[model samples]
Target: MPMAADIFDRARAASRDLEGVTRPAWSSEDQAAADILLGAAQEHGLTTRMDAIGNTYARLAGRDETAPGILSGSHLDSVARGGNFDGLAGAVAAVTALAAIRRAGMVPGCNLTAMGTRCEESVWFGIAYVGARLAVGNMDRAEFDALVRLDSGRSIADHMTDQGLAVDDIWRADGPEIKPANTKAFLELHIEQGPLLMEQDAPLGIATAVRGNLRYGDGVCYGAYQHSAATPRRLRQDTVLAVTELLQRLEALWHEIEDGVDPSAVFTIGKLFTDPANHALTKVPGECHFSLNFGSTEQRSQDRFAAAIAAMTEEIGRRRRVRFVLGDPVGSSPTPLDPGLRAGLLASAQSLAIPATEFATVGHDASIFARAGIPAAVLLVRNDDGSHNPHEKMDLGDFEQGVQVLAATMLDLAAE
Candidate 1:
């Protein structure tokens, strides 16, 4: 456990930004964190390799080399100025567990690989699970080329090239490098990004499902600018008011869904702003830009929310005399974790006398694997301050407990 703590500290220092850690996908900071993990794996006598998309893997050879392997770990990238344990904790826990297994001199029936995935944070490319998607062949070549890094405004391919990855080889591959046929199961251990675990007073959680989302990143409302003082309320076309009305309607819809349909439904407007260059205190605002996100654990809920958004936007736009241009929506269907795998994780925790609970989780790379027909599970460690911020607070003891459960589950599956 000291080794785990040491690796966490080193990763935090390596990726340290202004206040928290920042490891953009395929950036030097991300590579540095991977190096630290791979170094630990090597030190413990494990073999290491990198895929075309820069997903780092440290493998402990099994008794049967040809059999499907058990894959563990999580992404190494972080949101800008985000907490250290959001993604990195999972990777560390994996390598540390493997190290502990090796130190015990126990070789299982199949390989145990600790993976460090790249670009899991959507803040970088406005998409999640880029590395996992490429590894699993879920992403098309065109989608790969179309994605641009938000901050640098460069293509994902450009960023991969800068990191010395084989972009052409990745695009030319017939299938994903990590396939369901060859992978026994995938497990990811990440800190709970919300206050649920803390509120439950539990040190760990076994995920039931990953919430699917509908997101609009470039939604806009346009209206003609007018004199604020002279324009009458009925004559002026106000975009700000129109957007707020849409948001209010969306919130009301969410409340309805939460109360009557799906209790897991949630909505947020993370970003909203008026055009600063053209707007004035005396002039009526002409344009508004915003981001809208809706999530639910049920596909029917997602469909209902999407339908409501279309209807509400039309009515609000017509009444306010503004045009609403909601750019292409992006999202995925809700992914349910493998019931057998979930049971195994829960049994492991129970056997270890670790009091834990099961709950739904936000999106993670585990969803990618599950959708690819590879059984997957997620172990959530408690974090008090939540995630994607500077104040994440995951106790080392809780992390060790999670790792203990992860190692036990891997061992059980590998023996089979």
Candidate 2:
């Protein structure tokens, strides 16, 4: 059986030509990455198949074929120019661990499936967990119609058609669904994607929950345009000023929430820009655009965020005499990890003497499963340089430790 390092090496080599591990949803590069996983599964003598939505699964049958299976793996899709280990590491870990079990000639009590999901990154279609939702039959036509590619302005249905997927079956729920009835539990092995593990000098961590996030993708601020030299500072409705003040107010709100309400609450302004065609160096800007991303483990914190933003917008609009429009924020609520799976992972780590901590600030496909009432857990490998960057660093030793724990946990679960 190939070790975890070998599995990661093969994945990196296969995707080397793709832009910094970018394999966007329904893109050919994404298919190529999936093909690598398929080939590896086939080589290991596991039964491989692709679903209508393009999710591939490699199954190692258990003593009882009718029993619900343990599903493990993460997305194969990546954000443009993203790091290699962000989503791919989990899939590789699943494959490696399954192969190790096979090599040991240990037959699990229940079916074990290694999956490679598609389109977990929301950057492609403005919707997260597309593949996982589809696999579990959580996607509806209305939600499917709402998914439009940010770059091409094309519907998700178009992308599926382009990829030769059976869109009708996907939409009408014409096939088998990976629900709790047939899925005993879901597990993912992913990189920490932050510096917490490195700071604590640990190689692994077990996630406690996935943070709920609100994203305002098309927030806009409007003000009347005027000559920069002619408009008085107080009289002019400057959009730049309005936006700056709004941001400051939001930052203040962040402090208030975190310090007093919920320390886990976090917020960021990822994108802000003005239309180049409508403005000049001398003209006071008429409009500006920005994005707001805030997340918290507590649902009540999200409610407070909405109230604060509305109050701030009303105040700023009145004082500055400008219109403030925020796009409809779309997001998911926080999902806690399954206690049994989390405890199993912790025990496995402890038995191996691998130091680990608890994390709850990131989102993953595992969260989608958790929200659907399926038992789910995430094991994070310590990584440096953070994630979603070309320079992201994940040490081989750290990755191996995570894989070890994942394998042991799966074995223990299967025996139960």
Candidate 3:
């Protein structure tokens, strides 16, 4: 029997490998992370390969390779200042889960794929979930060509080339090689990253659905800059002020997302910056596109929220007289828990004698595969306060409880 300490030790070791390996955006770090996961998989006797866009696939051959497989893992990339555990934690857990089952002489029901996806953070192209998107055949060349990083002017295609992936290879992710039949279900075990489970005092939360989201960049705003002594506040058109107005309007619209919406319908104004620290610089950046997160179980409710939010952005931009170029709203097809799978997990939780609750996810790798029509479910480990800041931490007790819950769920799934 592997103690909790043993599991944590292995995960902690893997976490160390990914520490400070910040977003390569398009640099070698992305490739490096992929290499690391491939190596890890190889050690476990798992067959592995890297796709054109850096999405790594590792196979755990079951009694039957012809049977549809279940896949799970997190993105290998991180956001700027991303912690070592954010994405890496789930990756370690997936592989660890398989390793533990095998070492325990537990039999697996089907082929399993422990996937480590690339470009989860949009550091290179400002597009989140690139690895999952590529796996699902959502990323196209035209969109890839136009995407750019916040600080760097390099295009996404350029970054792919730098990572040893040709632009055409990225665009042409359409062959039978990248098809979706390999996955029967996608299960991702992740840190709650929020206080919901912990604050609610729930040992484990069954992820019911993932939040739908949209992201687009607005071109830089232009405005006159003048000395405080020379420029009248009333006469000057302030880019930041205009952007502020738009942001506030977005907040107002979000609040209107209906009465029965999920608690996670959040709209965040995450990043904002301006160039030319000098007082003389005019042409202030007008870009103020933030992400829209709509996480709910009901499709109609999500639809209402999206329509209302889109209208809100339009009206606010028009009022401010700033050109608002809207990009494709990353419409997410809602993924629900399989009733039979949920029942199996519920029974597993009962047998393990651990407390369990059901919750919806506003963010997750599980949702991507689930949206792609794979029956998917997420098992969450609790965190305190849900603050993603450096001060963020999780309860050791809850983490242990999570392992039991997860193990029980796995046993139940396999039994079926």
lDDT of 2 by residue, 1-416 (tens): 24556655666665664556767898777787788888888888788888889998888888887988898999998888888888888988888788878878988999999999999998999778899998877887798888999998999889888988887777553444688888889999998887899899999999888889888889999998889999888898888888889899888888888997577678999998888989889999999899998888778888888888888888988898889899788887878789999999999999999998886759899988887778999999988899887778888878878888988898898888
- Model 2 whole-model lDDT (C-alpha atoms): 0.85
What lDDT tens digits, residue by residue, belong to model 1 across residues 44-75?
Answer: 89899888899989998899989999999899
RMSD of each: 3.0, 3.2, 6.1
Q: Which model scores highest in lDDT?
A: 1
> Against the hidden reference, what TM-scores do the models get?
0.88, 0.87, 0.70
Off by over 4 Å in 2: 1-3, 141-176, 223-242, 272-289
Off by over 4 Å in 1: 146-148, 153-158, 161-164, 171-174, 218-245, 272-290, 316-323
- The pairs that clash in candidate 3 are 194-386, 195-386, 220-286, 221-285, 221-286
Displacement of residue 245 (Cα, Å) in model 1 is: 4.3
What ranking of all candidate models by TM-score puts the best one first? 1, 2, 3
Please give the clash total of every predicted structure, in order: 0, 0, 5
Q: Which ten residues in a row have the lowest lDDT in candidate 3?
A: 12-21
lDDT of 3 at 283: 43
